[model samples]
Target: NAGVTQTPKFRILKIGQSMTLQCTQDMNHNYMYWYRQDPGMGLKLIYYSVGAGITDKGEVPNGYNVSRSTTEDFPLRLELAAPSQTSVYFCASSYHGGGYNEQFFGPGTRLTVL
Candidate 1:
């Protein structure tokens, strides 16, 4: 209620299946991001938005889709889920000023594709 929240704390998918990772923030942040972290690797940005109805692709946007319809919601869509897509997905939000902004992350969704 105070920060970012992601749904389905855990999930498993078969090859070619699809699912949407839900994210929402109550902090009214203007910037939101979606990232995926593989085991023992750094977090790679998938997509981001500066504000509602505005979004942009990040380092790894393939096999993923996103939309920002409201300031509070930003969901990540996985189409034709693949084994390479199996990783921990995270959602973060932050204000884009003050020199260095801090990101608030959700608990994350652990996804597995088999």
Candidate 2:
């Protein structure tokens, strides 16, 4: 529980399945984010929250949901998985929101859908 950590390093899902990607940080960061990276592409923000109970959608929120019930936990839920959702999901956290601050990233969860 030093930095951001993601559970289930890898997963495979059939069409229409569902799962939750768990993320946790022990640094007490106020800002948390969920991002997905497609093959050969940069990270696309899926959701973010400034603190507990303050969640918002990011650049790509379709088919995904997130909730922040505590300062250290942020989970991303995938409903009705699809082929388009196949990618590596990353969780990040920052003490502050700005270009000057550093964001810690989790190892990522590799999800494959068919």
Candidate 3:
């Protein structure tokens, strides 16, 4: 099973454009998360979902949105993309929401908004 998968390994979007980053997990994880990593910086959570039908914004949710309709998929939407949103985005999933479980990370999507 593909633990986690993300589409478009790399992208370059013009400012004001919009895009959706797709994420899917075959492990049936209960918790899924979206995070962004900037150059020389640690990752910052953008959104998370504990389960299907339940989603929440994370530390950096501005200009971003997420939806979780099934245990296997969580997609992130970027609206009016800006240069500030340029970063490497990663999608991760875990069986537990806390530290008890290990999170499996997908090969990140590198996005650059010019």
Error of 1 at 95 (Å): 1.0
- Per-model TM-score versus the true fold: 0.96, 0.97, 0.98
Off by over 4 Å in 3: none
Residue-wise C-alpha lDDT for candidate 2, range 12-70, written one tens digit per residue: 99999999999999999999999999988999999999999999999999999999999
| lDDT tens digits, residue span 15-100, model 1 | 99999999999999999999999989999999999999999999999999999999999999999999999999999999883349
- For model 3, residues 9-74, the per-residue Cα lDDT tens digits are 999999999999999999989999999999899999999999999999899999999988889999
- Model 1 spans with C-alpha error above 4 angstroms: 97-99
Model 3 residue 96 lDDT score: 91
Clash count (model 1, backbone only) = 0
Model 1 lDDT, residue 107, Cα: 93
Decreasing lDDT order of the candidates: 2, 3, 1
Instruction: Please give the TM-score that candidate 1 achieves against the real structure.
Output: 0.96
Q: How accurate locally, in lDDT, is each candidate?
A: 0.95, 0.96, 0.95
Give lDDT: candidate 3, residue 16.
98
